[model samples]
Target: MKLARFTEQGRTRIGKIEGDRIVDLSAITGDNHSMRRLLNHYRDWLPALQAATGPMFALSGVTLEAPIADPQKFLGIGMNYRQHAEEARQAGIPIPESQLWFNKQVSCITGPFAGVVKPAVSDKVDYEIELGVVIGQRCRHVKAADAADVIAGYLIVNDVSARDWLQKSPTFTLGKSFDTHGPIGPWLTTADEIADPQDLQMSLYVNGERRQHWRTSDMIHTLYQQIEYLSTVMTLEPGDILATGTPSGIGAPTGRFLQVGDVMRLEIDGLGFIENPVIADCAQEVMP
Candidate 1:
């Protein structure tokens, strides 16, 4: 099932995508609250969702929101792609022996088609199209072999960053957490739908120009390995997110950062695509 969160009329609702329309789960039963809760108890909801009937809405008419906006641990992996790491290495940044993790404040979450606010404080805003993994159950010390069981689903994520603020700290939190910097979703495709997570293709484009193109197989450490490494350090709870990492072609390497009115379109093989228009300092949005 393709799970999503969206706004129709004036209220936020959760639903399952059925071609060009979405069947509102809330209209079916009062038990469903949010996408995060549905995922936390996927086994129950998974079967229940098949019976969902609702006041449906056309996909184009409603406002799309981030699939799971309330994740507690919004984390990102740095330079996990070997090709991207090689680019960083050439730029004088050492490649990490293990996964380099950072936090992306949950408040930064925005919808797939929403306007991405280019913070007035920095002009070095950059985009990193990443494959986002959302956790289904709380687990720690997860073996890489058992990691697949805890995954709920996946989506396309834009790890928008401000280069100036990123280099100001070692955590990469300050720069990564700016409001509206994290734009994730078109919708979340369940893990069961993905036959091989490591073999999917993902790419990103800025204003019609292709900037990134690579497969998840190019990742230096697989997604399960990342789960194992992170779970060893902290509890991986339901709704927690991990940006599996981005490939090369970020603005930093070419010094071609995002400016107002630029549109970012990211696509992952099974997860679908998300297009977000760049808006300056919250001023206004440009056409998609």
Candidate 2:
């Protein structure tokens, strides 16, 4: 089932998507309508969600919010795609021998259709389209073979970057964690619905022009290996999002950066798409 978090009539709720209509799950969840709660006890709620008969809302009437609004961790893998690694190399970054993970702070999370700010401090905004994996259960030291068991579903992630800040830190936290930089969702397409996560076709378009297009098959390290590598170090919890990696065709190599009017649309086969517009950051508060 496609599960989503949305707002209608000024109240936010969770629901299941059904052919342009949403079957509200709020009634079943009662006061505990957070996506994290649903993911934590997904097994227990699955049956009820499958048989839910709550009120349906027209998809256009409600605004979809980030599916997992406040995940404990929002992480990303860098250069996992062979071609993207080559592009990164062209931009003076070395391809890692193993998974190169970074944190895209949870606060950077934003709704799929929200506006991404082009911070006044920098002008080198760019986009990386990636497959986002949502963890369903908490586990540590998970084996590659058992990785699939911990997965709840998948969604689209636009790993927006500020290239200037990116070069200042090897950790990439600063560049990748800009507010509204992480645009994920449309909804989570449960793992059971996806036959092979590694074979999906994904792409990114900037203002109707295709900028990045590649398949998950191009990944240098598989998602399972990434999970194994990460879990070996720390616990993976429900509602944690893993941006598997981005493919080639990011703007950094070519010197093209996002402007105030550009819109980024990311899509993955079976997972749906998310489009976000770029807007100027007008906040007057000074960090200094």
Against the true structure, candidate 2 reaches a TM-score of 0.97
Candidate 1 wrong stretches, greater than 4 Å: 27-33, 282-288
What does candidate 1's lDDT look like per residue over 93-199, in tens digits? 99987789999999999999999988888979999999999999989999999999999889999999999999997899999999899999999888989999999
Q: Which residue pairs clash within candidate 1? A: none
TM-score of candidate 1 to 2 decimals: 0.95
State the lDDT of candidate 2 residue by residue for 151-223, as single tens digits: 9999999899999999898899999999999999999999999999999999899999999989999998888
Q: Per-model C-alpha lDDT, please?
A: 0.90, 0.92
TM-scores of the candidates are 0.95, 0.97
Which candidate tops lDDT?
2
lDDT of 1: 0.90
Q: How far is candidate 2 from the true structure (C-alpha RMSD, Å)?
A: 1.6
Off by over 4 Å in 2: 285-288
What are the clash counts of all predictions, listed in order? 0, 0
